[model samples]
Target: MAEENFETGDAGASQTFPQQCSSLRKNGYVCMKNRACKIVEMSTSKTGKHGHAKVHLVGIDLFSGKKHEDICPSTHNMLVPHVKRKDYLLVEIENDGSLSLMEDDGHLKTDLNCPNNELGKEIKDRYENGEVLTLTVMTAMDEEQVVGYKLDNK
Candidate 1:
């Protein structure tokens, strides 16, 4: 069998191999239905005679908060997606609630949605108070989202 290779970073040092459904744990990242999600729960069971053990998984989309579930044989392999978190400085908040962020390397991201959560509210408050805030951007499966934020005291 040809070994499947997975890249974990730009350095090409870290790698991940295919994981069995039965081996996945809650909070672990997995690729299901062509989307990257974080495992929320896992269950396993064996039915009547001649039935193979199956694993049931409940996952939430890492970026979108959407729920997904799947059932597979315990021996089935699942892809584990690579997730990256980046920090960006909040540059502006448009009138429509969209955000503008600047990366440390000077890249600008505009028209990004401010997440609708407590952290999002906090970031907005800080921005309204004229405080500089830095945001945590999460990327997975070619999707990007603002997941967290912190004040930039400098």
Candidate 2:
């Protein structure tokens, strides 16, 4: 099989956009507590006298996996993050815990570091074992990190 060229598809993608709180739904990306998060639960409070309806949101940080909650007026706007994911072929791992990943077009990116967690340990272990790996990276709110990986038969 030919190598898949991962594309952004979202041409001219921006970091974030303003969206009304009432429109957000579960499993969607949002910016809460100044972090990019995935909306897990949402509830709406009835509007009281001389007040607007309120939306309560519970989300998990996309990068850190920490819970965050926020409440906003239904009609008020909140920052919604432009979440993006891409897959890259692993080329090599540097001694300093950096990843040498190859873009679909064959350009090597060496900026991202190996995650300091179980996944990072797994990546290191598999790389050391000489298994081909494909890594999925997530980018949002101007931040990027490795989120998952798969073994490659190539």
Best by TM-score: 2
Encode model 2's per-residue lDDT on 1-154: one tens digit a residue: 9976558566666788999899899999889878999999999999979699989999999989899999999999999988879999999999999999999988998889999999999999999999999999999877999999999996
Q: How accurate locally, in lDDT, is each candidate?
A: 0.84, 0.92
Q: Global CA lDDT of candidate 1, please?
A: 0.84
**Model 1 segments more than 4 A misplaced:** 1-17, 46-48
Model 2 ranges off by over 4 Å: 1-13
In candidate 1 the C-alpha lDDT for residue 50 amounts to: 60
Write out the backbone clash pairs for model 2: none
| N/CA/C clash count, model 2 | 0
Per-model TM-score versus the true fold: 0.77, 0.88
